[model samples]
Target: MRQDEVEIIEREICYQGFYRLERLRLRHRLFAGGMGPPIVREVIEKGDVAAVLLYDPLRDEVVMIEQFRIGARDDARGPWLLEIVAGLIEAGETPAQVARREALEEAGCTVLDLLPISSFYTSPAKTSQRTHLFLGRVDSANAGGIHGLADEGEDIRVVRLPAAEALLLAQQGKTDSAWPLLALFWFAGQREAVRARWSLAGEAPPASA
Candidate 1:
């Protein structure tokens, strides 16, 4: 029912690579009565992530990224995923810092302003990874290009599309990810207000590429 109700009995690192896999033995208080039987669960501990939707308010467009996702290899649609800019939160780094860094590294754009969208668990049942999402204001004119740190084995492609079209992709499951879809829908409901505010400031960059 709550954090207090769930008890973490024991945890150990079963494996560690770029991320970590933890095997835990635990039990929780049942809603019907007392504590349930002890159970074993494996959790992926990849640390937290920060995801941002790069929005060029003036051009009414969104900057997206496309990259190969190993997890999606079994999907008939292929593993190359279209998603918002994101990266893990490193030690001594804030969510905002991660967002800005991932934006530049993945999409080649700098965030001018960041609007917090939400924070949620990526896979509550299987992973301890939580993601903080934001709507980032940017000038997307030069955003399109091959980016990502080569030393890290990254080969990313930046994409720019009308915000509406991007949302349509989410509705059709084309984007194939949660954070981007969530950001798009959130932006949809708040678009008019954001655009109105930006319009008054009269800050629209050169047309998005």
Candidate 2:
């Protein structure tokens, strides 16, 4: 059935803070071509985010960060999660802008070239959070260090490792999150071609192809 088939009976803000929780009561068409019973659900309203997997062609390295994530507090592996540079899209900023800003703030690197990888919803069933992913070429020579906004209570440790090793770790389930893992798998497939394209002797990397 189409979107119009779903009828929203009620929606309200259940909670509001750093993120929002909205309660929804709705129903939609069933397989039998009849309206289904109304169901109630709550969704987290975290606006879209932009994430970048930093790759340095010159060093064949990947730039990542380890930070404490409250959401992963109960994970068997603990809450300090390994992830790439990422940030929420702020007002009046584009996805690419957010990617660049996050790279500098989280990894202390200036992104030279950026390639669009994909966009995905983090958990459609529970939240309205979508993430735009990108592959960014950077100079990883001095990428490792502690970086984060002091006021945001962020304590991020920058990690630079061989791309192959990072990808292997991602493949081995070292990262418990989806965005970084997805970025690594995408890079693994496009590494050679992208490297060749970026080597064409230009100061700025080409736009997303």
Candidate 3:
């Protein structure tokens, strides 16, 4: 429960590349009392991630992306998965900054405003990756086509679907990514309130040339 309750016996870097893998041997206080036996675990240091679900309340549509994912290569649905805009947090950038930048880079949609949604661990058992999620307001009128940094080997295709259709996709287990599913579910429950709030905040700015 507390940091002091755990004692680190040893930590070693098992692998290092684009991401680092560390093996840790530690002991912690048991719930029943007294210290437990030492445990060894390997964790992938993936850093933190920022993800945003781009929404156009005025048009009742959502902007999503389709990209090939190595992790899902063997799945029946294929490796190309539908996902929201997301990127890892670079050195000095904030989660919100990453969200806005990723929205434009991945979907070509400029985020006019943002509403924080959630912060969560993607998979605690394997990776130390946390994601900061948001609902970003955008004008989806001209949001489309392929985007992403070429050097990064990112070939992403922008997809736009009506809000209802997108939600149905999630309900049917089509939008398989955890981030988008979570964001879409949250948007479904808060859709009306968000629309009202954003409407009162004033019209969204026009898209840049």
Candidate 4:
């Protein structure tokens, strides 16, 4: 269909200091058929952001960072939440690039065979941030290290733990971040199949290749 053939006009500013604002300015209907002007529900969604979920299949572990999350610092729980490697997509960086950069800077590991999981709004009701989730297998034996952007005023502590231990901690409600648990489930649910796939292809093969 052409532009004139569609309806529900939306206006948006796709860039700003730290975000892009989108708005559904007008709601209208299309000339579909004899169906009394086809209607459309107006929708305004954010463009994109990126998140990295690391899974170390070799060690059966996932590396997570503990940091003083200012957003949740004063939540009913506490500060210093556990989360997967995550960040917003910069002006010109791809999701894989963000994943690699975050993996090295936050967890101090070189990720291999990056896999994309999902792209979704972190919270649509409040913020217009679409986060792209990625899965990366890394060498967890030497993952924990002091790595973060001090110039950006970021202080992070990386830690590597067994998948079971991480899930247990989340189950006990120790960490306030939600992505860790989601990642845990994603990784755990696919653990056997991923491992089997990895083994069949050999360590030298690529998951996405």
Candidate 5:
């Protein structure tokens, strides 16, 4: 296993002749439990991912997308959700490149400058997903419309709202998704700087600090 890289070297797994789905002999290790030899576990490493939750300072709004999510199905949070614009990093794509591409694909806006917010895992124990969240300043006015790649069965509706209103919704738990909620509430605390950042878009007047 390389510390700098995610690659891991698995020794082998000798199952007890148990046949199951995929019938691949069910790989395991020589030892199990607290007192045993150091064995290799199923190591599914993750790659770095970049996502942007855009805020259009000029329109005093944030750019979000509404879509149906299976994970939140049959829940009070609502299966359909307003989430920060995001996508997985494609091959040979940088975080910045993913951010700019998703902005146009999901919201039809061009990112003027991408402001990083945080780098954290969407979940660690469950999956090896790492997310680098960004706050992109874009033109929000006339930005809302239907967007998304149809080939992937993605039916996305763009939503732009006043930053204050989004913050209020986040506080009230009206909006869904963790990244957007975090970004909104974070901006809530840094309203002055966020407002200034939005002002750079110049698509609308600067929001009051």
Candidate 6:
């Protein structure tokens, strides 16, 4: 379908704070043919995100983070969820920049190099948020510590695990976040190739600030 196939009747901001909620009334072309009835939908405007799965090929380990997520507060697994380095793509920032910056701020590791993984809509049905995922090469020798901005109410704990063990967590459904699960599953298939490629490209420049 094309952009012309959809028509927006009206849009209004329902809420605006840490996150924005917008209510849209629109109609779109139907599969059978013709335009469908106008429908109202509320979408959370989370902006776009950039996330990276940090891997240290030399040590065969992955650096991850654990932090309290309000959305998962009621989850049986608990509110402190394991996740990859991620942050919003602020103005004038590319996805790669966000990935690298978040890595240092949230994981205490500088990304030596980056391999683009995938870009995806986080939840198209309910939100307009999208995510750009990457596999970042890092030296995990000094990758553990409590990180995150205190003013942001973030108390993040760095977690380093063997790449294989991290993949197992994904396969066994232990880590429930979408970002980590997707990255790990992809890594499971490309680990060897990535390790080889990154090893050869020793100490490439970090993402531009």
Give the poorly placed runs of model 2, Cα more than 4 Å off. Answer: 200-209
Clashing pairs in 3: none
Ranking by lDDT: 3, 6, 2, 1, 5, 4
Encode model 3's per-residue lDDT on 25-131: one tens digit a residue: 99999999999999999999979999999988877788999999999999997999999999999999999999999998899999999999999999999897999
Better of 2 and 6 by lDDT: 6
All models: lDDT? 0.89, 0.90, 0.92, 0.70, 0.73, 0.92
Query: Which ten-residue region of model 1 has the weakest summed lDDT?
Result: 200-209
Question: What lDDT tens digits, residue by residue, belong to model 5 across residues 1-209?
Answer: 22332233343433323211111112223234223233344423445667787876655777888998988898875788988888888789988899899999988989998878888887664345778888888877778778999998889998878777778889887886888887777778776777665564535565343
In candidate 6, residue 89 scores what lDDT?
A: 97
Q: Clashing residue pairs, candidate 2? A: none
Question: Of the pair 5 and 6, which is ahead by lDDT?
Answer: 6
Task: State each model's C-alpha RMSD to the native.
Answer: 2.5, 3.9, 3.7, 5.9, 6.5, 4.7
Better of 1 and 3 by lDDT: 3
The best-first sequence of candidates by TM-score reads 3, 6, 2, 1, 5, 4
Off by over 4 Å in 6: 200-209
lDDT of 4 by residue, 26-86 (tens): 4334355532343333333445666777777756677889788777867876777888888
Clashing pairs in 5: 13-28, 57-198
Question: What TM-score would each prediction reach against the true structure?
Answer: 0.92, 0.92, 0.94, 0.73, 0.75, 0.94
For residue 69, model 5's alpha carbon misses the true position, in angstroms, by 0.6
